[model samples]
Target: MSETESKKPGYAEIASHFRKLIADGTLAPGDEMPSMRDVCEEFNVAITTANRAFRTLKEEGLTVVRPGRKTLVADQPRVAATASARLKRIARTGKPYAPNERSVDHTAQLRSMADPMLAQLLNVELHDEIVLRTRTFVRDGKRTVFAVSCIHMRAIIDVPELLSPEPFGQFWQEVYTARTGKVVTKSPERRGARLALDHELEALGVDVPAGTPVPVLVLVNTFSDEDGPIEVWEDVYAPGLWQVDTE
Candidate 1:
C-alpha cells in the first residue's frame, strides 16, 4: 500500500476531517451540514460511530444548531493548521504562528538527566550529562507546542541561553556546527495523531468535544549528520492545527 493509504482511521480522525473542511472554508457559515447518513456512507461507519464525530464539532462550538434544521458551520471560525506549518512555526519564524494572535514563546529551563539508553543511542558513556531543554508556545491562552529537545549537556553548558525559546533551533544548530564541524544535514521526523488524555485536555485548558475524537499531533525528530543521531526533538501540538501535507 502507498504510505497515505495505510493510516488507521478512528472516530477522531473522522471528526478532524470534517473539522478541517469547516475551518478551511470548504463548509462556510450558513452552509447546510451533510446529513448524518451522508457522513456514515462516506466514511463507511455505523450511525453511532458517525454521531461521535459530529458531537465533537458541536461541543467545540464549531457548528451551530439551527432551530429545526441541520447544523451549520459556526459564524466564528477556528483556523486549521497544516503539518509543515505546524512543525516550522517556531523552528522557522518568530511571530504570529496562529491567527489573530502572536504566540507566547519562552524558554522554560534546562533539566539534567542521566540515561544508559540515550548514551548508547548517542554513543556516550553512562555518566554523560544529557540535558533536556524545554520550550513552550501558547496561542491565545491555549498551549500549541511543547518542544523538548535532548542533547549532551557539555555541548551547551557554555551557552546557557540556548535553552531559551526565541532563537532555539537555528541558534543551537549554528553553535553545535561550529563546535563539532558537523553541519546538520537533515532533520527526519515522524508524525501521527491520537485522542488526548483527560489530563492532557485539562492541561491545555480545553475540553474534548463530546463523542468527538480529540486529536493531538505527535512529532518525533532526529537531527543527524553523516554519523548517526546528534540531537533529537519531541513536540506535541493541539489537534486540527497542523496542515495535512508535510514533507
Candidate 2:
C-alpha cells in the first residue's frame, strides 16, 4: 500500500471517531449509522474491520443493532462536555460555557506556584510567577463547576488584559497569538475522579465535615503552541450536578 494509505486508521481509531461524533451530539440518539458495507467502502477497509469497529461501539453502549442489520446511536449514551467540547469552546469564545451558564470570577492574579504537582506539570520552578485565574460556574442557578487556569507568565507579558476578570470578546488564544506572535496549536487533557480538596469543596459549595473525602470529577488540560506549554487548566465538576461530552 502507499505510505498515506498504509497510515490510515484501523478499526479502533474509526470506532473512536464515531464515539466522538456521538459524544458531541453530531449523531444524536436513534440516528442511523452507515451500514457496515458502506463503512467498509468509505474507510477503505475490509468488511470484517468495519464489523469489528461497530462491535466495539456496541460493546461500549454507544450503538444498538437494529433488526435490518443497521446500527443506530444508543439512546442516552453517557456524555459530558469533556476536553474535546472544552477545546471547541476555547477556540470559539476563549472560555468553556454553554449559553445558559453564568460564572463568577473569584480570583485573577499573578501568583507563585504553591501546588508541587501543578508546578511540575507546568515545568516551572516552585517560586516562579504564574497567572492564576479562578472561577465558579452556575448552571440553572446551581453551582456546578469550578475551574482554574494557570498560565505561563511569558504569554501574558504584553497581553496584560488576560489577567482581567472578564470574558474575551473573541478567542483568547487568538488574542495571545496577535500579541505575542505565538500560536496555540495543541491542548492535551487528562481526567479522572478524585476526592475533592478542601478548597474545591468550598468552591462547589459542598458542605462536608472537615476532612471529608467527597468524590469529584477532575479534568486537567495543558494548552500548548510551537514553543512550549502556555497554560494548564484544572476543572472540577460536582458529582451528579454536571454532565460532559466525554472523550
Candidate 3:
C-alpha cells in the first residue's frame, strides 16, 4: 500500500497534511486555511472534529486563530526548519559545547495618552485623552535593551492595581484571564535582518563597524481574547544573545 493510503484520517492526519502544505510552500505564511465548515465538509467529519484538527495545528505552532475569523498559517516554519538543520549538523561533528544560561528581569508601567485609536482598542472611555499602561522589560541591568509595551487602559480598569510597581503588578496571562476571561496563546512571527534605528544600537550595546551588519530578530505577537484580538506586541532582540528553536 502507498504511505499516504496507510495513514488514518483524523486530527493527526489533517495536521500532517497542513504541515506539508506549509513546508512545501503550498500555503505561504500568513495564508489563511479553509474554514472549519469547509474542512469538515471536505474531510466528511463533524465541526467539532475539524476544530480539534485546527487546534492541533495551533499547538504545533503552525497556525493562528483569529477570533471570529479564519485560521492563518504561521511564517516561522522556515526558522524552525533552519534551527533543526543546524542542530543536525552540530550533532554530526560531535563537538563539545558549553551551555549558557541567563535570567530575564521584567518590569511594566502605565502611561497617559490622548490618542483616539489607542483608546478605542483598550475599550476605555475617551475624555479627549486616555491612559495606557506601558510595560518595560530590562535584562541584566541594560537600560537601552528593553521591551516597551503599550496596553489600553480600558482593558485593565477592574485591575487598576496592576499599574503599580516594576513587574507590572501582574503577568500577561493573569491579566488576560482577569480582563477577558480567556487564555492568551502566543504565536511568534520571526524575521532575520539588520537593525534600522539608531536607538537600537545603544540599547543592544553593539558597536557596528562600517558596513558590517548586526543580526536583528523581531517577533510580532497578537494576543487574542475569547471573542477576538485584544492586543498586538512587537519584541526586538539581538541575535547574539537570544535564540529561538522549535521541535
Candidate with maximal lDDT: 2
lDDT ranking, best first: 2, 1, 3
Clashes of 3: 1
- What is the C-alpha lDDT profile of model 3 across 130-225, one tens digit per residue? 323332223224322234344545555655654554443325446558665677554344345555355455455567765566656654444555
How do all models score by TM-score? Answer: 0.47, 0.65, 0.40
Give all candidates' CA lDDT scores.
0.60, 0.75, 0.51
RMSD of 3: 15.1
| Model 1, runs deviating above 4 Å | 1-105, 108-128, 163-170, 178-180, 193-203, 207-215, 239-242
Q: In candidate 2, what are the lDDT values of residues 1-247, reduced to their tens digit? A: 7987897679988887786666545677788999887888788888888889889888777788878657898764433366457566555445455534567756889899987878877878887999999988775466777888888898777678878877666657778888778777655668778888898888888888999778988888887888778888888887664444433
Between prediction 2 and prediction 3, the one with superior lDDT is 2
Best by TM-score: 2
Model 1: lowest-lDDT 10 consecutive positions: 94-103
Q: What C-alpha lDDT does candidate 2 achieve relative to the native structure?
A: 0.75
Q: What is the lDDT of residue 225 in candidate 1?
A: 62
